[model samples]
Target: MDIWISKIGYYFLNVGIVLVYGLLLGAFIAKTMARVQGRIGIPIYQPFIDILKTFTKRQAISHGIMFNLGPAFRLAGGLGTLAFIPVIYGNEMFSNFSAAGDLLLVMYFIFFGQLGMALGSGESGHPYAAMGIGRGLAQMTAYEVPFTLAVVAIFIQYDTSSITEIVAAQQGSIWNWTLFTNPLAVIAAMIAFLGMAAYPPFDVAMAPNEIPIGPPTEFHSHFLSMMQMNRAIFAGAKLILFMNLFFGGATGLIELVFKTWAIYMVAILVGAAFPRFRTEQAVRFFLGVPMLIGIASVLYIQYWAQ
Candidate 1:
């Protein structure tokens, strides 16, 4: 009973940490982008203020139960994904619920909230929302091919689907990190990471000008606040996952922050330099070069690495 209680407490603690720092990191990204464009950016604390104001708003209309639950589902997904990954190597305090599941479970949970959000959007009876979800889902399918292949290559090379074990294998030297040892797989995965970050070139799902902020077009007030919080947490979670898999897991909080932030900046830099891709263009791009690289990575690992 005590063990179970500790696990639950740790889960919440991890979620809290992610929420706070994630928002700060997101605000930093926004500020950086603004500066690059030669403008004075909002304060680093702007996200917190926006979220608070959103929660305090008086008017909120719900299309139905799913519309009401959509944000909750998205938030849950972010937290669930965070809970499954060990945050700090060999640190009991920050390991969270990672012992309860492996990499495959974490992968499935990554999509759980997305499917829920899609269903809720569908129930909202908004054509734009549905169209955005469809495009997002199609793009997701395109990227997952390469992402999955890259993951499979890592699993085969390491002979474990347990994330903790994978991290352990990469220790002892910087050269042991997958980014150095399996460059092909890392390249494929990082390309997919760009899409997962959902910036320009892959952000048609939430194109503010084109679809008026699709998927959550009907969401406002507290619902919007929850979605904002989820975005922060989910973005941080993805950064951590990449850091663990390719950069070598962090040994301490400071290292964790540095590694994740550096990786996050890569996505931001790419997003700033590129323009949005139509859904079909994004799909074809991923399926072509990224997919081929992913397959070749697996083959190289299986044949040459052996």
Candidate 2:
């Protein structure tokens, strides 16, 4: 029972960490983008304030049970994904439920929330919602090609499917990180990271002007708040996954913050610099150069790295 309690505590603790840091980093991105465009940004606490206000909203409507349940599904997905990743490598307290799973499980859990959101949005019967889901799924498929190949390369190089084992292999030296050892895989994964982060050139899923808020077009009040919270948590979870897979996993909270924030900033920087891509254009771009790089990385690992 004590063991179970500890696991539950760690789970909530990690979720809290992701929520707080993710919003702060997200707010920082907004501020940085504002500066880039020659405008003073909102306060760093703006995202927190927005979330609070959303929760305080007194009125809401439901399209159906699924629409009402969509946010819950989305939030669950984010938390479940985070639960599988071993944070603060070598620390038992922060390992959460990672002992029960492996890299493959983590990859599959990444889609749980997305699939839930798709079902909920579809039930809303909004044309824009359906359109956004279509684009998002299509884009996901395009990027997953390179991302999957990169992951495969890592699995081949390490000969393990456990994330903890992979992290253990890279310890004691910065050069040991996959970023240096598997540059091609890193390049391919980082390209997919942009789309995963939902940045410009790949943000067709939420083209406000074109789709008027996309999948969550009809969500408001507390439901919107839940989505916002999930956004921050999911973003942080993605950063942690990349940090574990590419950068050496952090040994301390501070290291985790710095590494994850740096990784998150890459997405922000790319988003600020690029213009949006049409859905088809984005798909084609991922399938082109990035896919080729992924394939090359796998081949290099198989025949050359040995």
Candidate 3:
């Protein structure tokens, strides 16, 4: 009973982290991105506060009931991804039962959130939103292959499926850190991350002038607010996951928060300063550069000339 309770607690905690990261960092990303464009930044908590205000305000437009379920399950997907990562400080929230599952599970679970939102957007009856959503899906395809290869390289190098084991393997050693040993992986992952995070170069999905709100054209009130929160948490969580995997986990919450903040800053600044990519161009860039980088990571990991 005690063991079960602890696992439940950790699950909720992980879920909370996922949500907080999204709410805080999503706003931070938007603000920083704005700053890069020479605009004054908003408060870091702007998104959260905005969400609450929006929810309380009027006009909860529903494109259909289907749109409602998208955000609901989309959130579930994010929390589920975090829960499955198995890279928390010690054991995972679900490690007691499924140790074999690792990064693969994390990668797969994320699609749930992304795809759910995508479908919901298509149902929104907004042409711009549909166009953006379609482009976003295409963009996802462009990057996912290289990203998978980069992950495969890590799995091959470590020969393990457990994220905890992978982290432990790198413990107290600089050489073991994939970022140092596998710069190719770093490049590939960064490209994919930027794409996944949907920054300037890859934000065709929500191209402000083109798509407006993209899939969220009709979403307002609580639903839209939740969507904003989900985006924030997903980005922040990814920052932590990437850093912990490549750079090493922090000794505690403070270092963790601090490092993740720095990571988020880099991401947001880059997003803001850059211009949004043309859909075809963005896809080509990701497919080309990331594939090369991913292949290099595999070679370096497996047959580095050392």
Candidate 4:
């Protein structure tokens, strides 16, 4: 019982650290984008303030039980994803509950939150919300093709589905990292990541300027707060996942932050350079070159790289 209690405490601490890092990283991205476009942008503390304000506000409208549960479900998705992934690798306090096959479980948790959000949004009876859900799910499905292929390649290369084992395999030298050892898979995964990050061309599902405002259009107050919090946590968790998979997992907190930040910059720089694509265009793009690259990766790993 005491062991379980200690694990829970460590998990919470891990969550707290990731949450803060994600929020600040998001704010920095916002500010950087604003500067690129010649605007002053928001304060770095804006996200923190927004969370506080939203939580303190009363929910004036209720959209039924599922509607109420949507944000919670999304938050659960983020938390669940983080819970199963080792944070600092080897560090007991930050390792969370990571175990064999956690890579697959993490992927499931990622999908779980989106589906929960979809159910909640569907219950809201908002036409735009429905449209948003459809687009988001469709796009998610399209990208999963290449992403799954990339994972398959990694599994074959390392002979394991456990993320910790994958990270372990990559240790010893920089070239040992998947980024070098399995460049094809990394390329495919990184391309898919552009869609996964939901930036620019792939962001049609919930683009702020779009007519379809997407899932959380009807959410407010504490509901919105939870969603916002989850967004940060989820984003940060993804960055870490990529860092572990391809960048040589960090041995220290500073290294973790730097590597994850670098990985995120790949998406950010791409997003900044491109214009938004229509849903069809985005879907086709992912299914085209990225998909081909992913397949090639699996073939490469199975035939030659091994």
Top lDDT prediction, candidate number: 4
lDDT of 1 by residue, 1-306 (tens): 998898788778888888888999988888987998899899999999999999999999888999888889988888888887888888877787665237787788678778888888888899999998998889888888888899999998898887888888999999999998889999999999988998887899998987977898878899999999999889888888888888999999999999999998888789878999999999999999999999999999999998
The lDDT values for all models are: 0.88, 0.90, 0.73, 0.91
- Model 3 / residue 140 / CA error / Å: 0.8
Higher-scoring candidate on TM-score, 3 or 4: 4
Q: Would you estimate the TM-scores of all the predictions? A: 0.97, 0.96, 0.88, 0.97
Worst 10 residues of 1 by lDDT: 93-102
Best to worst by TM-score, what's the order?
4, 1, 2, 3
Local lDDT at 62 for model 2: 86
Highest TM-score model number:
4
Better of 1 and 4 by lDDT: 4
Give the lDDT of residue 150 in candidate 3. 87
* Off by more than 4 A, model 4: none
RMSD of 4: 1.1
Worst 10 residues of 2 by lDDT: 93-102
In angstroms, the error of model 2 at 277 is 0.8
Question: Would you list the clashing residue pairs of candidate 2?
Answer: none
Alpha-carbon runs more than 4 Å astray in model 3? 28-41, 86-88, 91-98
- Poorest 10 consecutive residues by lDDT, candidate 4: 207-216
lDDT tens digits, residue span 78-112, model 3: 66666655434554552322245567777886777
Pairwise lDDT winner, candidates 2 and 4: 4
